[model samples]
Target chain A: MSDAASAPAVRAAIGDSEFDRDTALVPRGPGVHDIDLSAGWTIMNAVNGGYLLAVIGRALGQTLPHADPFTISAHYLTASRPGPAVVRTETVRTGRTLSTGQASLVQYDDDGTEVERIRVLASYGDLDALPDDVRTTAEPPAMPPLEQCVGAEDGPAPGSVSSPIADRLRLRLDPSTLGWAVGAPSGRGEMRAWFALADGRDADPLSLLLAVDALPPTAFEIGLSGWVPTVEMTVHVRRRPAPGPLRVSITTRNLAGGFLEEDAEVWDSDDRLVAQSRQLARVRLG
Target chain B: MSDAASAPAVRAAIGDSEFDRDTALVPRGPGVHDIDLSAGWTIMNAVNGGYLLAVIGRALGQTLPHADPFTISAHYLTASRPGPAVVRTETVRTGRTLSTGQASLVQYDDDGTEVERIRVLASYGDLDALPDDVRTTAEPPAMPPLEQCVGAEDGPAPGSVSSPIADRLRLRLDPSTLGWAVGAPSGRGEMRAWFALADGRDADPLSLLLAVDALPPTAFEIGLSGWVPTVEMTVHVRRRPAPGPLRVSITTRNLAGGFLEEDAEVWDSDDRLVAQSRQLARVRLG
Candidate 1:
């Protein structure tokens, strides 16, 4: 992992280790900290969706004893409880080359009322070891490298917190990111941009997954609209790319009513498919 | 719901109460039940794939409050844990017209060591009470309706438990479902079939949803190989068809190696797209 001033910090708060005492902010743990539903980002009053994805990534990394290179391919579904919840995980099977684990997120009131629950299917194993034919033939579009990709002179306007929780997360758009991206030469239409995260968390598989999901606003083709929090996100991790130089790709599959299902492919500088995610976001135009 | 005479008598030895528990089973609370871990018709130690779908169906039903003219759709993302485990659901949102719920499932040893976990996304609400273009235009296929669809002669061998679970749950099937169904009308391809499930119990929305998932035997295309079960199911409920006479339509989207993904649509005799589902079944063909 490269450490540059522009790199995102990837550790849980110091002494803030109360939630996942058993696991590191990055990975390797029997358990992870229980995020306080009441604290943290407020989107929907449910735990911040970004944080939830981070935890899921951490749990997945820990469970996959051998899954060094993998990416989430698709998200078939999403379910969450409104609350501060604690997530726990169990490894279903761990093979020399393949493994499966399930993670359960439980939302509890201060009274332990058990408000919500979530389960995640984490698949881990060796991808490169698989036959060449199984590998994805789709290559990243050739474009000006990150250095050549320019950032928008004016970044996200000020006071743009559409959701109270998003506001609480202190999310900011960095202008330098525009130059940090390049779309495929094929004119796939989808844009790829790399942005700096506010917290600058290390790009662990989980954090990386979350950060990748947070596509820079510039990726959207249409003009600004209110941001709808993700109801649920399913990410398939294909392989781990270099820590920094996060590559974000965005595309929309089905859009209807006030809801849309979007997909993003996050890559490393090497252009290896790091993770793929599907999100159902409630959209609102400014 | 009416009970057919030929309904499997497997429930007899287990006694009337717990034996017939699959239909009326409710969540112990707001958590997932690792029902697949339990044993029965399929195998001794390995989980019976169909039972997992039944458990999920039951959980989805209880997550929503009682209402008339409601529907649900779900897709199975992965197969279930190999052994006995039951998942319970927690209601995420319970509104007068709409409700959302989440559940987690885990496997455990007889000593209570947890193993696998899964999460579910379910929504229930009353239909607009009026038909719209969104309604299903695909009229119920001309195949013989439910009762007349039975194939005592052409169906699974006299005592072949290998028959698709849908065949067993349904009172009968059209000639299309005779014996074991394989592939679509093109016959060159995917497995497809349609059937009807009786309101063996209350025939409520949840019950119907469970039936919808439990109906399709994606792993059994050629027929149940090992213990293929459902890990997670995502459902979408569009509209309701009349109660009693249930219509089930199934299509396999893709199948490769030992893994397969399927898309299923459930309709009522009236031809309403009651629910839609996708399932991932792990095949361990014997």
Candidate 2:
């Protein structure tokens, strides 16, 4: 955390590291924060969806009494062009244990009028009161255990692990699923990988946002790639994370109309479901 | 439509058809609407998630310049109790082709202080500008045509179809998938059906909200039932529907912490995908 002396310098170092700096919402009037968009948080030129949602989630946490974000939903009103954006939060509903509110990322136009980029609604609560009587008939996909997976350092895989986000969040792809990325494009849309912060910070509610949206668009496996911009996304934090990498999987059974919906689930190393998200995105067409 | 001469009288005639009535937002103070929740709109005693979202979506339509709701994201902040509620809309981003805003449902507490029930972020646009160059590999689940299906009119099976929402929305379930509701348990979490308005009114964006959530909770197939309140939900409109009933399929591959996420897709009678939604819900446990 940077102090008042080097706050400007911290803001200058944009990208994955700036994510920590950008989401830092202090107690100001109406929960204010100067959003920072640094490297790897971008696909082509626009800011990544998960990165924007994470910033909004952090701000919503500071604005509400309950801090652990149980759920967050975001609508991309327009293409969120990064750089010097203003985030503002408002209380929608302050409930007993959960509080809901809306946060907006706005930037100024050449004429100096504020233009909103993205809007989000988030719910916050503490872990002490998480639901207890949990049960599931369908289990998440079984991985080959952590020891058998390959991380970014493994290098030269079927598909290139190159992106602004891959630097901050290292991904370990299950070797079996790489045929679509590097070899012949598989007709099916699916991707499974293990994700962890490069700095070794344990995954948290904020980091889970990145983990969910950080994967290459599932449409890529079906042979379509080029900046999938999210139109809307919703994330549910099922449980807090343990001290380990997150096992993540994304699947898109339907890709149509220059659009596709991707469903993602994130499980901690403990094998507990940590977060689940689904998003609608427009596939960039030639 | 009821006239101002008998607004109170109409509010008393609750159920599926009133869905259209309850969500009719007039431009009062900041696009105002006195939410009317009649019977069946409630599960057990609490209001249903889809009912609340439909009401808010209607209000959002009145509040924005682009009237079509292309996408809506709602986070249930608190259990919405029945009775008269207030819904207000505020602009988040006013874009050229699309506009985003936040709408909230609130009620007064016993002490007369206003409390929030559900908060939503909605995006509105015109259907004339819908995506054209859309392509998807996955077609909606093949149905045996409408006549071959069974509707609630067929009467009692194993599980009771008697709910507050049953009267407003009529669902035609595929017979093979009903084992969990009756006879032996299916032991899986999934549900597929065709949905239409009970009143025979053409389904609109607001009505589609009802169609998505009106299904018997997928958890019921796995031996879990009762009130399943949605925690967070996101809906994306792919295209405007043609004149016909909607074909819907819901699947839940994970359930934990008294919470399960349901993914739903709606295809219009024209066999074109109209809308897709996913929501996290808490299954009521004894």
Candidate 3:
């Protein structure tokens, strides 16, 4: 615990955090919220799926009595761009231990036509109230120390498209998985990275939503190219992070019929599994 | 390819399949369907989550232009009993490659008040239209030949409750995982089995939904007992299955704070990966 003198400083830092600012929401009505999709969090022009989920999650946290999202599943109907959007939430059920709800992120074009981008179903609960007892048969993926990994700012592999989200995040890739960064692509469908906010803000349960999908597509390692759009994604936030960079490992187990499944796991600084996600995406090969 | 004489028999078998009858829905209106919940498909007393999803999938298939469910995510709100229920479906979007929709399973209580049981979001497409290109880094779990496994009809381990669903389906458990039934758990947090319909009904894409969740909870192998109610489950159907018994494997990787995540994979007779699922469930320990 820090001394009382640093209390205000901590509060001020949280207030200035870029993630907090980007995901901030303005209440419009009973269950409607106004949000802005920040351009800083994009991969090849499309807004990050996890970032979009976090935006919707913020509104959900405000609409329901529960403060944290335990399980969230979103299906991307269309690609979203940086613009003003609205999140409409409806409470499906409010129980003693958990609350379930649905939310939709919609935007309008010049003609004022509404375009729905993503639809989400989620359940919220107080994560702090959970028991500390834990039993896990899975171990965190192997990763090198922060100093030995390659930073995202080092730039994309030679011919790949630059990810703007990389600048907003402190992401370091495991050196061995970077063969795709060069001409020689490793056939292994996996990627491991260390993630944190570039502004040094501690990651919370909300940001873990973004952290789950912030890495490059796992299909990249298997020599498949082009934009791989996510059709559906589900994330389970197991616990709150312990205030440091997160360990993320993603793998594509099967690619067939122009589609692939990527499974991701996020571990906190304490090496506890904080989140897990699986996304189904379309893969186009040249 | 079979001769013409075998065609009618095959058609007749499918028509008589119990799975088809139980999940059959009657069109009540444009988007509403009336269905009957079958008690034969229950674990303890609550209807099986996967079976409920398949019933909803059937409705979604009828409502959407696309026929097969490619991706589906369902949140279980309340336990459902065997009786008359209604499934309401809404089309979200129709795309060239995929179509998205939502569905709700509801029933009335003694007071005639409506109660919703499960809510689902799913995308549908034609599995046969998908390209045949295949690349995989994951392999099916190893299991002994079908004749060597322990049949479900042999009865539940010494003190466990008998599953009615098991009697309706031909399910066999790998011998190594049977320790839990004999009062000693393997502590591996995993279960593998062979699955088929007892009526010799050929498993199709729709029935694949049931096979994904038709197993004893993986937590049972870890010495945890009692009801493990699924809070949410998401399934991705990779492709249609080959006609024969299906291989199913489920594993529990993490259990903390009264919740556990079970990941399941189903392989067809031809050893092709047919479906994959991950479910979050509540676990109560004595």
Candidate 4:
């Protein structure tokens, strides 16, 4: 992963970045695509849910006749690992303002028996076609200037973090919310941060899919840790994001019965709501 | 719709209620089922988003080789009218703890053309097989006793309420939050009520689905009215309900740029959190 200063060069090699490279779906024929998985997307022993979903989204975007992903949702049925997988797509609906479809990623065993892992449903639409009557009173979160925000340069030692996917994205966390880094979690289940590709690629709909779930689990602030597996996640892309870093904030209302919902809002630099996402995850007992 | 005085017969007909009857998908052939639409499920010329989704969900539940629905998500592609429609489902993934599938609802035009209207992605699981480490601190909202709650018996005159769907749902609306029933709105976009099938049927996943969207749009309380069409919705079932009324509450956080989100939580009479839902909808600008 590249630091902010060398991000452009890294961006140039985005085609080689584990993220961009692994998610690159090659169209083999109609309704089908070939994919290559990488360990860089793994957290612990399982593939990162968001990373796997981005691959599915990229495949749907490439295989289907759509310009941009308006909403991409995935239900994690089982764990996926690094290696060769196939994505199969089927048209659900095609409309003037939106196109809908479904895609699945599955890994084949030694005998070529495929086991399904991720199931995704996507809606594609022209961002420009959105109604201009946008109305919301949501103000941007209180964030320190980019310079004052803390990036990976100040994070835990190289071997300390649990997720390797973190190395792929550059996160400038809102300082006040970084207490978890020091082992003093707020115990409040909330997080605010500025995120962009470590390779400096401009944010896009696919990247927003990653950004939505790439952040550390807000449950960690509630002093709960260890694999917080997402059962399902749905994202709504409301506006086209302007090129720049994205500001995101997540809040967990209640962590009840080992199941919790995390709601996040993604805002562009101009304070426009670009996307909104909510995920249901099963938390590991403390 | 019957009142509490004749609740048993109402409950008896629940298995044959309009919502239940319309969503009782009958398998006509492989990956396809016949569904009948009813005006009882409509608010205007358009069918209720939640009602349409339950039909889709039930279809998936029946067509998919799975048990209970854990996650049911749908993105509305077009407005649907009450009539004959068919649901077509395709298997996405079949796993141990979870099974995933996709289904679509479509109606034929008078010209013999088929148009897709609703697209749904569902994750199924065996609730009994879930982990027993259930622990949550979520408490039911402060609601007065059942006797003190005001049922629809006291609502606006028959011709006043905008949504006819309310007549089919027995809602004991918390009176303090009913300003919108009059010209004076609460202006806070929030509501808490005791909800049940107007026919006195016990709550189920389908009813919960309807309940999520069946309420008068919270936007109305915020001084916004007219047809507030839901763009997409995701429902997460936390647990099965115990018999009796469900205490539920919904809140809208922001109404920005022609779009808004509503989050709702349903708690069984025993105060167990049963389901949680979040929906994104286009607002009717005043």
Candidate 5:
């Protein structure tokens, strides 16, 4: 679908709803609350981590109402595996300057099976904070212009790879960092670059969360299986990247026992950290 | 109770179990071969993350059906919060030398709100691998001996920093790293260490998960209304640390708004990395 055409679908996928009221709550203590495991609930299995995060995000929204707030940056710390998890929410002091709140999701099996947990910290602030600290360790280098971008409707397309996500969005690869990005037109209200992802599928918000969760991918065609879902993801979205010839940079830090973490930045035609993100992942051979 | 007498109590507290067959099956999966969330099943809630991990460790022991095995090092990326969470498990691969499995938990509210999702990658290996490189990155400094460690019998002599954990364990703060740990005795079983955990009060295993999901007090002591739970944690137990002074090294990597992530490493007196953990915390000011 055209970027414009995809709007309704994306909104349906992410739009607000009363279905959110279906959430189950369990009291943790005097002040804390937890999700009740007895509730028959689960999101679409594809992009679970991010979808689950969206649910928590919505709850946080209830805690602190805001405007057309974007998750400029989000950090998810995994506490326990999802089943029988714990959810805690706290309102940060926004002080009339920012809209910020934090929540945690922990999973456990029995009293003994503590599998995973996640912490999500989010803020919605005024747009006035833009245009500061332009300096970065590096910037997205020059690439083919939009018309010249691979898979551009008009340009000479780069040889296609076996990717499902490729079919969903247009792609641009930066020669400098081998960083590649797949995004629809900017109308969707979010900017995303695709360089590496597991399952080789088009990543929705949920898949994006999972992709960053894995360690950075070095060579193409590497598949990972045994990665823990994202422990935390820090996302800072400046202005959405300019539409065409988008630039992306990705780097990985750790790889031990099929587990790793990597950070990525997407830039617009301008050399700014339009969106910066980090994810922790496990690396296992399929 | 004196430190010596309370040592067992602490052990019991950490080793307690509230899980039954129904809870244990939550992580199994979708079909009859797996656990069903639609059936309204849940896991135990009072156990802390560490203890829950131990239970997972135990379950894994049976899953592999191996006689002799050990976990080298496990790192938790997130923490699970209390809620109506569900779990699904898949065995990524099974091998003679190593076996890997993937588990995901999803939390929801009583009204059926989706709270969080967690994915975990766990690996088990034969103990016959080549010895690990023991070159320590940081040397172990001198500290009080085990005898000087306050036992359940000894209790804090007086005017000591009051702790909720059993008195058998006392914290030794290293000036260099500003890290402290409280541990019970050694020789318990497969794992042993001194560490500090928040009191869960009367909360169940779910609350215990939340209490430990907060940022480990390894470094900064900044105040917030409450602590955020972790999203995921991967733990590999290589060798149990000898009962003595346990040291925890905590460092905060990022904190924006109410979301934060802290990385921690637990070491025995011998300076070996017993466990490496990372927690994502959502900080909210009262």
Candidate 6:
């Protein structure tokens, strides 16, 4: 175990935003850190997968030489709760362009046995150092202005569990896709929203990890009921987001055998594509 | 290492297809196998990323309890060549529905030192056992009749390297996007094709791994020159492909700082979605 004197000083820095403070990690040893899973980030009874990914990203940011995550892939083995957990990171390879590594988030049981919750592999690099050339053939999904959107805090559908993370994360939904919130579903299998942090923290590369998975399950639009548990998710950070709320659009094109796939794209205030993600989940229909 | 008598019998099967023969693995010990990377699958002297992934998939299929890959994410650390290699797989978790594991493909130097080539993590499950319910909102891309399309072996652009894997894999390209082959790019950043094995082998769940990446780089349509090395790729298998050639469509929505993302979707002859993939790559401009 590492002593307090050798701990990473980033955790001790004052005036950090709520997003940073909640995701802060204290170095416990080489390639290991102690994380405190904060409360009020749950969707149902389980901690949101994106929040947990952000926590892991924080640890990797400190452990690797690169400052920004280029790509991240995570597999959810078990549900995580708000409590004390440990993240063990191992360097997989270090190259001139990118550095790769893997990390596991684990919690302990009453019997002192370790229970692994999530396993992640990621590559890190400096996004600002990339070339300045931009060529885009795809445009952002059409969305209403921020003031015209439906607030995430408008309350959950009757009998559905409220997601406390929505308020903390500051999400606004597009009205056309909000039919699922009422008794009428559009059956389009899509969801669009605006994302920002409640604490006014400008979106960056690390926060983009959360933004990718922040939207409601697109399955909801198709009248699918029950918790959609994500089995695996991968996110590619294209560029650092400009300062402002992000425009997010998620769509589900196929749902088979009780399993569905959701694809998401995030555009920054500059309307640049910042990050893209895909996740596979199982629908536990009620 | 275990003696030859304890090796897996699947390698000794008499009537395996060329695809199976090229990807066969002989057990060396528990969770380890020896593989021979065959020649003629190169794209600029480096093995195709999808073909390498299939090699790793064969090992995971034998080690994990589940027989079909549900999701696979691979990071290319170094280019692979045709040679003798070894794959080591380690089980991560085994559940009632899915099993997860990780594998590494490494080649040895003349000095007896091992050089790691690719690192992959995958989850496997039985596709046949999944529920018989499928809901789809997306359709396959429109393509001309097979006779109206251009054959992959028609020849490469004047200065580009010819892909030898096309003939073996039986790929037919959509003529509308073939301007890149004539030095007059369409600048659409998209590629569509029909994929089938030349050996008359019916497409299966495992083969979908290779099918997702069988098309030409979409960047070619936008006039990007030089080798585009894939940094990382993730594929999600949705269903077992129906018998016949598959419809594949790949598109690049954004390209920034010399890095680009290509998204692909594969549909069976019945027009059912079988697999989807997204990859991040660096484009080395000539």
| Number of the top-ranking candidate, with DockQ as the measure | 3
Binned by DockQ into CAPRI classes (incorrect, acceptable, medium, high), candidate 2 is acceptable
lDDT digits (tens) for residues A103-153 of candidate 4: 888898889988888778888777776667654656777788776877777
The lDDT of each candidate is 0.45, 0.73, 0.87, 0.77, 0.38, 0.83
Q: Give me the runs in candidate 3 sitting further than 4 Å from their true place.
A: A1-12, B1-12
Residues A1-286, candidate 5: write the lDDT tens digits: 3332112232322233222332445555632566643222222222244345544654565565453133423333332233445667666434353455656665665667644344455654443433332313344644554433333233332332233233323444433222322212111111223332211222223223322322214322122212244433454444434322234555443333343444555555445444445444434434
**Model 1 ranges with Cα > 4 A deviation:** A1-51, A63-208, A215-227, A238-286, B1-21, B26-51, B57-166, B169-191, B198-204, B207-231, B238-286
Model 4 chain A lowest lDDT segment of ten: A5-14
Span of 10 residues, lowest total lDDT, candidate 2 chain B: B1-10
Per-residue lDDT tens digits for candidate 3, residues A1-286, read: 2221111133324446788899998989988899888999987788999999999988898888898899999999988999899999999999999999999999998899999999999999999999997898889999897767787445556886667786678788898788888966689999999887777777898899999898878887898777899999999999988977798999888999999999999999898999999999999867
Find the candidate with the highest TM-score and give its number: 3
Docking class of 6: medium
Which of the two candidates, 4 or 6, achieves a greater lDDT against the reference?
6
Which residue window of length 10 is worst by lDDT in model 5 chain B?
B184-193
Candidate that scores best on lDDT: 3
Better of 3 and 6 by TM-score: 3
For model 6, residues B1-286, the per-residue Cα lDDT tens digits are: 1121122223322226777888889999998899989876677777888888988988999999998899998988888889899999999889999999999999988899888888888889999999878788878898886656776446554666666675567677889988898899999989998887766566887678888777788888999776788888998888888877788999898888788888899989888989988899988765
lDDT of 1 by residue, B21-60 (tens): 5434434554543343433323334334434544654666
Full ranking by DockQ:
3, 6, 2, 4, 1, 5
- Off-target runs (Cα >4 Å) in candidate 4 are A1-22, A63-66, A142-150, A155-159, A162-164, A174-184, B1-22, B29-31, B63-66, B131-151, B155-164, B175-177, B284-286
Model 3, A127: alpha-carbon shift in Å?
A: 0.5
lDDT of 5: 0.38
**Model 2, range B1-286, lDDT digits (tens) per residue?**
2221111232222234556666655455655667655655876676778878888887887788888777898888777787778898887767787788788788888999887787788878786675575556558876666656667667656657566666666577876567765656587787888776666565667778877888878877777767787878888877777755788888887677667889888888777778889887777666
Q: Estimate each model's TM-score.
A: 0.53, 0.83, 0.95, 0.87, 0.40, 0.93
User: Candidate 1 chain B TM?
Assistant: 0.62
